[model samples]
Target: MKTKHHILTYALLALSISASAQYGSQKKADNLFNKFAFADATKIYHHLIEKNFNADFATRQLADSYAYMRNPDSATVYYKKAVQQDNVPIDYYYNYAQALRGIKEYKQSRLWLKRFKEAGGLIKKDRYLKDNDFLNSIFNAKHHYFLAPVNFNSKYSDFGAFEKDGTIYFASSRNLGTLKKHVYGWNHEPFLDLYTTAKRTDSIVNHKSKIKGDINSVYHDGPLTISKDGKTMYFSRNDFNKNVLGKDNQGVTHLNIYKATLVDGKWTNVEALGFNSNSYSNGHPALNNDDSRLYFTSDKPGGFGGSDIYYVDIKADGTFGTPQNLGNIINTNKNEMFPFINSENALFFSSDGHAGLGMLDIFATVTDDNNNIKSIINLGVPVNSSKDDFSFFMNKDGLSGFFASNRAGGIGGDDIYAYNRIPQLKIEGSITDATTNAPVPNAVVTLLDSNDNKIADLLTDENGHFEINIDRNTNYKLITQKDNYIDNSRTVSTKGIESSVTSIKANFVLNPVAKKEVPISELYPIYFDFNKYNIRSESTAELDRIVDLMVNKYPYMVIKIESHTDSRGSFAYNDKLSKERAKATYNYLVANGVNASRITEFNGYGERKLANGCDGTKNCTEAQHQLNRRTQFIVVKME
Candidate 1:
């Protein structure tokens, strides 16, 4: 792909620079900037800024120069200030967002991307907005990878790893023990060249030498792919063929994909592909499992975004078929490049088009026999970060692999990392009230592992959220308890989970104890045989329920006991009998551990609280008279 200079407008931007008229001539600075001489342009821009000469305009041009120079940390500092100007173009917002990712400011990156979208710039559809659990899934997938740096990493950019015959072939800008004869203006580093390393055992080999087939060019080259048969290879390089560097009408050199044959232990018959054009770029080639199809990235017309992945059939006679686009399912309005098809036919590529943790994330796709994409998944975490992660390659076993990332803690501009799959499992969990569905905050949760050992003691937050990390192929039990709610527990297992799944979510709810009103509206018969006062065995069970609530459930509940008698007995005798019955009920509760002070009153009404006018002379049935022989425990003060 062409560098950022291809997009810089000299005449228009220079005119705009002059229009900002708070300064001396900005023509020289704008001219050098447009001429791809960013180093000189940056110096002039800095000089103008030091003079306070059109500072905002100079700052924006300065940031663009640094961006084209491949220093995002420096570019972002100026971009952050330049984008704040009201007259700045919408593209600045988008560029600022991209620059932010280089510094791992993902939250700010997304914000700027959103602001870019609001300012009428095209942006990828955020799948996260449609799926609430999308981001958690990313966090879980991140645990599956363990990334480590290679021993051969240099102070310069070292990336693009490919492996065959236990030998690693990679691209590097290292000088190979010589002073820099030629340096790319983009990053001021030596132009990239193909390098080889001999893999001995489990560890990655160090950089030993370059390819031995007249492949080392004085210009930029490399990032090659070897066929399964190891008989043929395809690689990327500048438009340098036959000692001539081709340039387009814009006077910019574009990259081209070239095919080479391995003969007599050395590469030979190198030539550019049929689709090579001086106008656009075609590079980062990949080959399918059987070598019948060759895939590569290009920015040719009539495709989506900045770049797209295309493939061609490798004819038997060494001719190539027409290139076909991978289609919208795999391509997006943003970039999709560096395609790698593993032995299992899974297509892995790097992209900023898909919603991910940050800038460029590696993605994999499930493809059908005809190369039709079925699904796309983000390879979250260790293999990816907020920086650019691309050029993914894997061994035949699919367990071990390598890729490049410019994320933090790297050795150079971009560092190649070796990685293997590491299974990650955790529980994305929540707690809530079972009745109202409201969050149950401050709930104590206990976790027991498969071995019946307490593993974690967790307390939920105000929003009823708890994170639990667990093991694969194991069973776990969760017990949650909270104040004013009944204790509850649940059992979960990670057994039989698919290999791709990283986490098993555990959500729980709690139910508040029932709050029954305490009144005499529905009273049970408190019948004593004729004139006696004693608790019945059957009635005592129901009475114990009230005692349990006051003593165990709600310890602060206060109540008063009341008993009534029918009109059959004399008023004075009935009153005394009723008082005895009330005292008996209260004694039962007090004996059952209910606090004595909780019994606010114990009184009785004798023939006064009557039912159905059943006076002694009225000749009422026993059932009708029994209605008045009832007890009431009225709630006085229940906290």
Candidate 2:
């Protein structure tokens, strides 16, 4: 036994020596790799193979070196050789998978990803998807990436990209010692500069073109909207026009729209666009395909609130008339910016005031007839997160474009992200009380798909407004209910319609279900945090009591659960949150075995008063204030 142990120890030591020697070669390769001397690293790695050294690691290193050198074909050969020798390191698998994906070996790359995931590898999904050298063409490929935030460095950042005209235009605020940074000095960089890359498409590093004649001097030069004719350029800059030079020489004070004419294909003459240029912040311009009209953003007091979409017709006299604010329906008291008009005349913008997946998200709204907000739909995930996601620009095909986000994980601060906007369907509406005719604030609205499985739950606003964006090709049952009130429901079909946004008005009227003498119990079971109308677990028991009463009183009574929030912020903001919170509690009930059809409504009050003192005041304790945060049940049907 002692002799056997000695033999095993010696064998183990020999294997360790071999692994250590192999690792040493890989280490040397890594040093060269870090310096970006790929060619030299490849040479050294190949030399190891010639010496019959740890060829597995050497071959993989050689493959990476070749890939960095843009010699993908040679890289593939070496990667395959390494894999053949059981060289299945996570890095090796990731690199090899990327190489395969680059060469269009999608199936094989997927197999490798499975193996890589199984190996417990922590690979960066976003890096792989965004890397030009990697295969990023597959649909839904970005899902693997862990969303992280871009580090908050002081560099001005916005969405930017290389234009088809060979002029590289992007939003930035690098300062470069400019006078006063930007006009408003909003947290984002004040001056977004336009840079062009010298037509050297050979190397990725050489892509940065020069800025054309310091066109970006003071103000915010960003969201560049270039003309297809290449003879004109339209951009959104802070309200500081060189033409607006003050008597005492104070700088332009507001963001305004500007146009530059390309003389001899060179952008030389820049002029402040006529009447359209306002004293308020007017920026983030988007153009019609024909260049006949300009679409932009402004907060000129006449607007809906923070900022709203405004359009001006390019008159035959080469002057813009009065800019028109897209009405109250489209513009809310909440901030709306980054308006992009597509070829279809469909308007796309970013809004914190709309129902969305995050802080600021991309939304598409159609302005029809009276230019009302016909349909307001959210552009969901990958394109939207719980961050400040905005600055939308899509290509003609409408498949891809660039957007700016401070979301997690990027090469730099607030890196510009390219995403494919997946088409979706959004259902929106208001839930009100049938009896009171008042908005049934804090109501739960659950939507079940064709399989009778609950798909989404949305709450109504202070005014009982709700909006939901989802995918099409499904049947849905919208159930609304609140404590003490009967529940209500409606069947909706999302098929055969290209509607991205649809609004319905559904309200539930609650009949007194339990005898008033039973107990002076809470009207709703859901509770909100102090000053918040959002539903909390503490309110469940009270809500359950109502649900039990409904189940017993009429035996067949269908109840609707709804939520409400007090008004605090802007209507757009309060309205959106109130609607969502109402639906959350509705979902909880349905998940707990309540009949979907029996539950009728969910709603949010936003800042609307349910009880006057509930809107958060020092006059009440946090506990008492929480009493105002509640969910209600309305009897929808007694069968």
Candidate 3:
């Protein structure tokens, strides 16, 4: 949790070889890789891996080579192995995820992307949007709530639900007692006023009545907090004082927190909080469990962002002390409103700036002993939606609660909802091929706890799907494996889940051990001058390529070399010249490190093999005759 601020900051080889003793060192492999000579790099990597010399690094480099060569299928195979080793770095998770995506393993890709995000990956916008585990992690919460709109919601905005002393008190835009329709311009409805009704588990709260006092002002008010003793109340109201509206220089009416005392059973003596100002807004007042401090939202100048949460000491003389901003951890550069601290000392608030489903999602805080925030966990799913969900009020039991939302199917602009939290204990997903997108039926999926202790193992059905119920609020790792496929190990946790999601998706994408067509190297025949048996300067470069191939690129590759001469020379002379040319070619390769045994055959063919039918009888151009003096390399055997 201390790392939350930093969280978003963000193949190949095959073939056996002859004489493993001749294998290159890690330095040689790295040099080839640096030069983008992936084919050459792959060979050295394979040899290093075979000898168990820093095999983990070799495997990762090999996978990267395949990736650079645009072979994701092959890259996936090696990456699967590299990632399993504990010594590898976090970026491997991203690379493996991409390879999985390249092979159409989206489900598996999401899993690895999530791993990357949790491991403090360097964040790219596209990847983060594609897989936000922070949001997904909410689905793993133990209890999912069944939400239903409270029956008393009106067509106008009705929200800020709270309960005390067997009565439900909330704010509503409903016409207060049929006084002439006075619509607040913000939402084109009646001015918000405090309303109350008897608390009931069923049926409508139709017996609603407006709170009577000097408290119900003609301007906006309500969304109030009541003390445990029920004598005093703190509520938000527009800066309408003494029957006059106070505005800032811009003629904007800012809200203020007003205190009202219940004297002789009827509320009176309404007074504005000391920090209330005409230049800025301060509203949404709440009290901590002990009431020593008052928590409220304010757009004051000294805050972290838009409307920050602040607390002021409630002095014994009824005068407030200096207001302290909640700091940047819980406040963002957007509106943070409706601050509520349940009896458990857990502070819940609504914000649009944090990582959430959409506008104004409610988030709960986890704090250390000093009240410093550790993590601000979003209340996901039913408690939150792609719309405004806020004013979360948790009951004493912590399982039954009321909140408000403007989500689809709500009765009004913002509808209060009642819910009971229930258990959600299963994981669901399917198995499929990373490259093929085909189902991997019969693949085994093993579930393990945070300690790597096995909890259960299950096999996928014909559709490659499986589901297993497990204990809640626990960390688990999923490992899937099948013959001839690379295994996938993914970690997940059930935390910050406060809504109705019965299961978390844990899909497995199995990447096959890819076998591809032999990589072809383009070959151009090296040329020689007429009657020349010595290796040409240009021909040496091509010969050197052949050496690298046999020694590093293809260890088991076997080749037969044949050299030819032009018709300009006598048959006997040409035959001797061709023989010398072939010998020279063979020696160049062997001297440059090609295993001598890989040279299957080396022979000379004289004028009998003239490229054009010149035969010394017809007049031939020098260019045409030059072509006949050349060497050919044939693949005698390859694995």
Candidate 4:
């Protein structure tokens, strides 16, 4: 039987090897993939993968093909499969993470990125894994921006919005149908073209139409920057001349910057800038306020990573200087593109290298007098999301702006989003004694929203003052607490406060707790067993209540503990035991939080102050004897 089983196993193993060999050769798939024919390459890879022939490599290649083709949904499946196989490459982990993020699987993407980092030999692990305050600000910050998609978005990718003079100019891949549209192999979408629409109102934009003149070319064009004077325009376009596409040594056509002059109400004199390159992409032009500096993104030699922001001086003679990289402080080993400068001299750009919420997040960097980066701030959400967010543009007021995002629930592949900042509300208050109207320093003042969630807590200064910023159109509760005083609370609302500096005064008056004299009989009694001085757990509740009353409610009150015992033992023995019991009660209160000095005295009177006839030789019930063996508190003094 054993020999027959071994023969069957051998035959099965051979059959499996023969079946795996039936899958087609790997060379065929590589040939089509190298030619950028990803659609056809994936078919052969899928067939080989079904037969489990070179499954790991086939899965990774299939994922890479769909990823290069900009189909993250399809790529995610293969990438997931590739990652499950043993000894997968490190790059496969990163690609899987990016693919997961493209589909809004944020938590899963982070897991893969963590795995990618742990695989060792990563050059930018520290840069990518560092904790970022800007990334955290997205979750803890108050909702200040309201974002919504614009009306002109189409089914294709539409982004890179810039508003100039009453007209909104942006880039889109929507085919106009008048000309033979060229589809980009990357996403299989029509080439990007510049379109313009009039800003009908602050929130609404009119129907978009193709931009006039030679600006809209047969190939990719747009993401333009207009000079302050509105007479000059600088735009990005593919390296195309007279319907002929230019290619570099790697056969990749790069983007170029072109400048045009407005002649007789029409954009004319269009010419490629001197910095235009055929080897590397340089596009997304942005001009400074005075037009003295032109900022753009490039993948040129010596960049930190995929794409970096670079600027060239537009000299007095209108000639361009050599492009200067923004340095490693702003650029990283990953891509950073879509540079925009605001009136404040702050540069806003999108980067995937920085520690972020997952994918490309928008960041703002400001430079000091020496042109060194002072600080980099992430724009955070809802201006940014796990998906790609870039091309930020704002008006002079800074209260509103437009940007681009490929996050879910958008109107197109990448939609233009408008945001408006909501005004902030301020709350300030004073904490004072109710009877004397004196400032109560060191009092805790806390603010909570309508859901009873604590918003902020601050201690009152010497002047009994506290201040905090709050959100508008919300209800809140202000609570004040202090030692030796009753806690006070007030409900306040900023629902109707519309002004930018609306300050609400919420003064708190806490009443001091009065001293009270109570016999230990009224308060829960501390009883002792025969000949015992140890404190009991059942008596702790009443003892702690007195501690709280003395330490917190009546800080100036002094307490006197008195102890008594039954007459069963000798007079001298009972007296000593009563005193020990009194000392035990006093020590417990002091140890629990009551100040030692507040305990004015502790004394015992054994059998001398018996409450009933059970004293000495009298017959008594257990309850009657227990009542005589009790500890009591007396109000000695109140400062």
Model 4, stretches more than 4 Å misplaced? 1-137, 177-179, 200-208, 242-244, 424-493, 498-639
Better model by lDDT, 3 or 4? 4
Quality of model 2 by C-alpha lDDT: 0.58
- Predicted structure 1: lDDT: 0.73
For candidate 4, what is the TM-score?
Answer: 0.49
Q: How far is candidate 2 from the true structure (C-alpha RMSD, Å)?
A: 28.3
Clash totals for all candidate models? 1, 75, 6, 0
* All-Cα superposition RMSD per candidate: 23.4, 28.3, 22.1, 23.3
TM-score of each: 0.48, 0.40, 0.48, 0.49
User: Over 4 Å off in model 2, which ranges?
Assistant: 1-156, 160-162, 165-168, 175-190, 197-208, 243-252, 276-278, 367-373, 421-639
Query: Please, what are the lDDT tens digits per residue for candidate 1 over residues 318-429?
Result: 7899999989877887777788878755678877778877766788774332445645667887787888788898887565779987788887877788986644456768
Per-residue lDDT, model 2, residue 396, is 64
Tens-place lDDT per residue, model 2, 1-639, is 012111111100002224334434545665554333455567678776775555555676688766655555687788878676532456677667777877888778878766776787654454444544222232223331222232222244535443554444565555454345443333343445665543323223211433564356554565567766776777655455664532212433555566887665467677767754344556767777688888877766666666677788887877877788877656788767777766555677787777666577777663323433445646566777777677766666454456677676654445566554433346677766555677766677777766655544445656666655544656778877566665567788766774323343334554434443433343444667644544456667765666566555545666555555554457667666766777877776676656777765566666674555655444555556545556666554556
Candidate 3 lDDT, tens digit per residue, 29-85? Answer: 664554334666787888877866556677898898777565688899999998897
